[model samples]
Target: MTGPHPPRPGAGTPAGRPPVDGNAAAGLLGEVLAVEVTTAVAECRGCGAHAPLAQAVVEVDAAGALVRCRGCTRTLLTVLHVPGGVRLEVGCLAALTGAAPTGGAPGAGG
Candidate 1:
């Protein structure tokens, strides 16, 4: 679960026009991002300490992408990103964010 990202004030308020509620805490668009979690980032889910599980990798696609902790299997969000903006679906944060999956992998265009 994540906290609600409130929309900015006056985002849809226009002069001499009715304020649009579409930007009210939802229905907003922004740039995407990507992330690759190496196996060395294991941490304690209870104490947030790292010191367990040798190696495990997870690819995230957004600024706040969540993944299963290697030690406790708890959901952990990542803020890492690729060279360019993230372009993965926010729904499946655990999996790599990309256009689509081809041949059981990402970017393998068919």
Candidate 2:
């Protein structure tokens, strides 16, 4: 018997374009977290789903980037590049867990 079919390229995309992965947010997330963020675990506020930030669905363009939960299509984060610096919107993330940049507790002087 055949298994369930997978989603099409544009299955849940509003613009009918395939969504990118969270790796697309590397630069933005790196600046915000001061560390590699792809390995960080992000908890989605909408569906309470947890996954590495690298696994989140992402959409990027000239304006900036948007990260969403793969399970519920709920936006989890947004990053905007402005003249001064990058602006990060993360109200949709309930929590995030990861190793500190220096491999120590966050805020602990190395």
Candidate 3:
């Protein structure tokens, strides 16, 4: 018989803890962005390492999410949900690419 399952990778941590993968960040980003952000490419400013956004380390909470580079543990992106709009901080990415609109906007030509 299977024993109790092990704790999830980033779960069961102390308070103020964040998940350890970009999946959480992607979910939070989905609330604001219309594109599939996780599949995008991100170049870390600190180490100049390039990888998919999905590979970044992400810490998520009710207020916002923090994304960091896997290579050097440097902060890459931050997303905050605030009144009226979301605040995004992207100080860690030297380059990012591949984003498409989610579509279905009003007052747009078909």
Candidate 4:
């Protein structure tokens, strides 16, 4: 049951690269997402932790934005502005639940 464990939080990224909250990615994600994604709930496939996307860890730069799970720091989603449009990569995101509009039932998307 015991083995070499993965690096702790803040260990996955390059040195001196400080991780920020998911809110930092709101602007980048806003380009494609219609809903308020920061308020949405994201499920981590790696750790099975369900938390608000706002709580997730994010790293953004000229390339794009990387979203990681808050509980286990697992890669959840990545968005990159490509040549023609945008390239979105889903990693350890098991599910994403966002609030529905008024009079609409909440639904889940993955």
Candidate 5:
């Protein structure tokens, strides 16, 4: 399942609100969220081996993230849950906001 990484649009939960529960979080399905990439694909700086891409799961504690690399099959850096991973950039955020980054909203093309 390879696709763009989802990003978090808002900061922490409400300023003065209780934390979200598992059921609440589960309800977020198909709600369209985002997360910047903590780490993207890269080759081993040492041996020049292909570093497989990975999906970093977001955590609530703000702790580092977890990535299961494909090539080395190893976990690399831990993310702080920011926006835009290595390959992605904030410029493309427009798409998530119902707009297009290239120009105006995407249009039919040949």
Candidate 6:
């Protein structure tokens, strides 16, 4: 007779629940993005696909988050939580718009 196999690593989830949507990144992104970036439209340079940032697929690890285009799966943004602040690296993101600017104007109060 055979025995039951052990659970696979990273299969499904720890609680055996389905994966969460991109909206789950809202809280983490809010503190760094400083705006409702999730709702903003993001254009992918790779495949010319346009969609709200919230619709992008996000993968998080010990380092930080990696946002990819849902259509072409090309990396769009990489966010690294550093010592004092967050480090953002942009990739195949052609444009990001429709999100209201936060704080003051650029180079206004120095």
TM-score of each prediction: 0.23, 0.64, 0.58, 0.62, 0.23, 0.60
Off by over 4 Å in 5: 1-40, 55-62, 81-110
For residues 1-110, write the lDDT of model 6, one tens digit per residue.
Answer: 77866656777665676557768656544544565687778999999999999999999998999999999999999999999988989999988875445643332112
lDDT of 4: 0.79
Candidate 4 lDDT, 11-44, residue by residue in tens: 7345545556778666545433555588889999
The lowest-lDDT stretch of 10 consecutive residues in candidate 6 is 101-110
Cα distance off (Å), candidate 1, residue 40: 4.5
lDDT against the true structure, each candidate: 0.39, 0.81, 0.77, 0.79, 0.35, 0.80
Off-target runs (Cα >4 Å) in candidate 4 are 1-33, 101-110
Query: How many clashing residue pairs, candidate 6?
Result: 0
Which candidate order results from sorting by lDDT in descending order?
Answer: 2, 6, 4, 3, 1, 5
Candidate 1 residue-wise lDDT, 1-110, digit = tens = 88975666765434534445545423112111212234223454444646322333345455535555555555445444557754333321233232211212322111
> Candidate 2: misplaced stretches above 4 Å?
1-32, 106-110
Clashes of each: 4, 0, 0, 0, 7, 0
Q: Could you say which candidate leads in TM-score?
A: 2
Q: How much is 62 displaced in model 5, in angstroms?
A: 5.4
lDDT for position 67 in model 1: 50
Model 4 residue 74 distance off true place after TM-score fit, in angstroms = 0.8
Look at candidate 6 and give me any clashing residue pairs. Answer: none
RMSD in angstroms between candidate 4 and the native structure over all alpha carbons: 16.4
Q: Over 4 Å off in model 6, which ranges?
A: 1-33, 101-110
Clashing pairs in 2: none
The deviation in Å at residue 46 for candidate 5 is 5.5
Instruction: Please provide, for model 3 over 32-85, each residue's C-alpha lDDT reduced to its tens digit, 9 standing for 90 to 100.
Output: 466567877889989999998999999999999999999999999999999999
